[model samples]
Target: MTDQHAPVVVAARRTWIGTVGRGHHERTETDLAAAVLAATACDLRGLGNDTPTDDVVLGSCTGPGGNVARAAALAAGLGVGVPGLTVDRQCGSGLAAVIAAAQQVRAGDARLVLAGGTESASRAPQRAHRAPHGLTPYARAAFTPAPWADPDMGAAADALARRRGITRERQDAYAVRSHTLARAAHAAGRFGPESVPVGDRLDRDERARRLDPDVVGRLRAAFTPDGTVTAATASPVSDGAAVVAVVPESVRRDLRVPGLRVVATASVGCDPALPGWGPVPATRAVLDRAGWSVADLRAVEIVEAFAAQVLAMTDALGLDPLGGDERVCADGGALALGHPWGATGAVSVVRLFSRLVRAGAPAGARGLATAAVGGGTGVAALVEVVR
Candidate 1:
């Protein structure tokens, strides 16, 4: 028999709602934060609710001093007393924030919360810092890897591609599919309602358009000397933000909003040397916790950190690389949408929500979302389509 007192709260309603960023160019960290907050506020208004949010969680991999979340909360018009937390788990930061928010809700810590992630790769470059001389000798020694090991994601991606037997042709094919799906979604106006357009100041949503065919050919190999991965095949360094509002099932029913539910979430760490494989263990952990199998999932959104990483994950999961059994990144992924580091994971969730709603899957149908991060850490979340 089921435990009647078990936490039965659902996700309520999660809307991609709004996104804002500069065109495919550099944007200020403050601007990105403000844009994200503004978009979130607009989305809240659309929900037609004035209830005070219990908490705010923001994800960001890079930003001005790593304070994007706090700044965003303030800019979004939340009260000064409203608690806010910023999370950074590399590429999975945003998704991690969402998972954390959901966990808090399930544990009865809060009845309602706002969760999302943002990134400004163009404005916030990868950072390297020196440890203070006050540290112990051993501490300093251990910190050596911090500076030297900060390799470009492209280089890491190239290495993984070659090691994992991913070929140039396969990468190109995936790129083509990503663009095709993104173009289709845009043309069909599927992403229109969710995308909050930036104003004349920004002129365009930096990552909201299709890739250029000519640019695809002109791209040079990235990372290794003869690496197959190119800028075209890899996700662009761009800026963007996404947010979701989570509430209790009772509140959902009262409000009459149909949404998704968080079933399980897991974060796992692996050897930093094999960063690309982090998702394998994370996936296993979530599935184990939920007692579900890959066969039970109707859709999956594995962050495309690189073509090779996606290829490796699919192979590890025993999924057909070319089959359509699971709608994997049915819309273009980071490769096409741009990887805003901390925002990518949350963005993946938004995509998952959009895809599930469109497919009209039955209640209890599962969706798996995963993202690989630096230092061999990955996060995965299992969500159910709530009836």
Candidate 2:
């Protein structure tokens, strides 16, 4: 918990993100996670720190009930000595798992931990709720109680966009920017080094295409007739996994590699009606704890579940939403990359590691990763590049 024993991320890696029913339809969550875990472990060994992993913690949203973390750990060949834990906090699952691992390391209970998230939307099994009379089928479980408002994510995003006065033009512009940057990043080979190929495809994404702004303007609203949210503005049903190896600063120094030192973390609750607002309070909390403001951040990454949702968060945080804030999602976000639910939170961190550490940013340059959960929650972590 102190400065000496602070947790740091020594290595990060992720599987190739694919569309739900297209590229990753045959691969399950366990498969995707195992691939990334093995890749991260290889990274550790490459750094000459092959200490056995103390735990394997993963987050999942739609996985079948059994301990999928343990299954994934075994699938990754972590052996029986390591235990596993699975966390489900809606979309914030991956970040929550990472923070949990960090806390364990801070407490001196774990020397090394591998943590991240996975999602297999295509492989999500059908479910039937058992009622008194018979069985009732449902698409997805509710995020709020029956008495509270729990609209579908798209509908809620559309409603929030309308309520917050975020017009269609702004939303479409953001979406186009995301696609353009993501495509450019991939073309420049910025993503290849961080990717762990899982299937036939190697270091390629199926969703990152530049959307014509003219065409984006003509598309109809998907949630409401007058709403601004559209297919292009929302993240797709995706499948992928991402993990980071967490250790104390001492271990990182011995490995002779720079890392992102955990400065502070915050997880907070907000109104369920507009879940996009979750990140606002969470980000503020971390900034407050770290005694830094938005202007001090060198880079920032937020899970782009929806264009309108992320815009709302950025707008509230006093960051320019259009293009002035290059530090925020410079390479793009889930909009173009695909939102694999539980895996999205971890993906944000990996992107930060790329933007900061991999890019040779000076030591102490701070970066942040934050996410908005579906069930009225936000999770965020503040880290700085450590030499």
Candidate 3:
């Protein structure tokens, strides 16, 4: 019953994620994006000769502020004939780029497309706007007109934890588990196939993998006085890139490439004051559209913006947040691996591809990748392994 013309992911890859200003400091966002895009293109070609890519779409939050997608395509040697586009939907940018490409393929605009996201936090430009009459500069952008209501991420996380009865101890425990799982997955070489070396060094996510419960507990609150939310529970600023090749299912069959059918995508808006809750409704929307329930998913990846937020989401979905199910980010998540802003969502897709496609899961095994965006936006995508 699989639709041969459905959009499918045939290849997926990502640069080794790095902490902000450390691992990929020497490289530009374009450099990171080009590396992943080129690797994906080469992989697609290796699979077959007729897989012509029509466009490249990339999501970026704060780069050099130009059309980074175009720059990356040219840098990847994909030729000027391939058009490019860049999107900025905060944390959802990466997944949104993939969705946009998938829609184009579904509309029969193109047979193949490259889509994903990249972010070089270290190189992100320092932005400022001139005041009236060229007075003082504004250093930050406002997410809402009511400044008092728009809480910083940490404040929102702390509030969510308090309202949801998620204790500081529980958050710390979840962080520890994330690190533990990530280290174990890395030791098992789980990241080898999907990870690409970045810059002049071998690829590795050299973030906070080692965890000491006592140390994490002792860390002071990062955003609010007497708050439970700390740096340990929040996603770190990071740099990286990820890309997936989207082709029709028929093309996948012709090339003998394993297919991960993108069955449905959903995006929704929530209260800008509490952005973390965005994922709940978005995931619900997608599942409803696909006529599937959360329990039906074989694997799931939710951006780890904060442990408290993730805990809330798990409760909403009626799942155990720290149970360490193989279906939920088996290789760890943003808490341990670091969050590369725009690239995090696409990284989730790359993880799904690895879990269901590269690992040869049984046909029809379903997966989900969802994220809560900065401006109270949530995006989710559902995919199924196709034979």
- Best-fitting candidate, scored by lDDT: 2
lDDT of 1 by residue, 215-254 (tens): 6656779777888888667876666776777666665555
TM-score of 1: 0.84
* Tens digit of per-residue lDDT, candidate 2, span 1-387: 337689999899988889989888888899999999999998899999967899999999998888888999999999998899999988899999899999998999998999999999989888889999999999888899978889888988998798788888999999998999999999999998789999785458779996988999999989878788999999999999999999998788888899999889999998898888899999999999999999999999999999998889888888885967898899899999999998889998899899999999999899999998886889999999998
Could you tell me which residue pairs clash in candidate 3? none
Model 3 Cα displacement at 360 (Å)? 1.6
Worst 10 residues of 3 by lDDT: 134-143
Assess the local accuracy of residue 288 in candidate 1 as a C-alpha lDDT between 0 and 100. Answer: 96
State which candidate has the highest TM-score: 2
lDDT (0 to 1) per candidate: 0.69, 0.90, 0.88
Instruction: Name the runs in model 2 displaced over 4 angstroms.
Output: 132-134
How are the candidates ranked when ordered by lDDT, highest leading? 2, 3, 1
User: What's the lDDT for candidate 3?
Assistant: 0.88
**Sort by TM-score, best first: what order?**
2, 3, 1
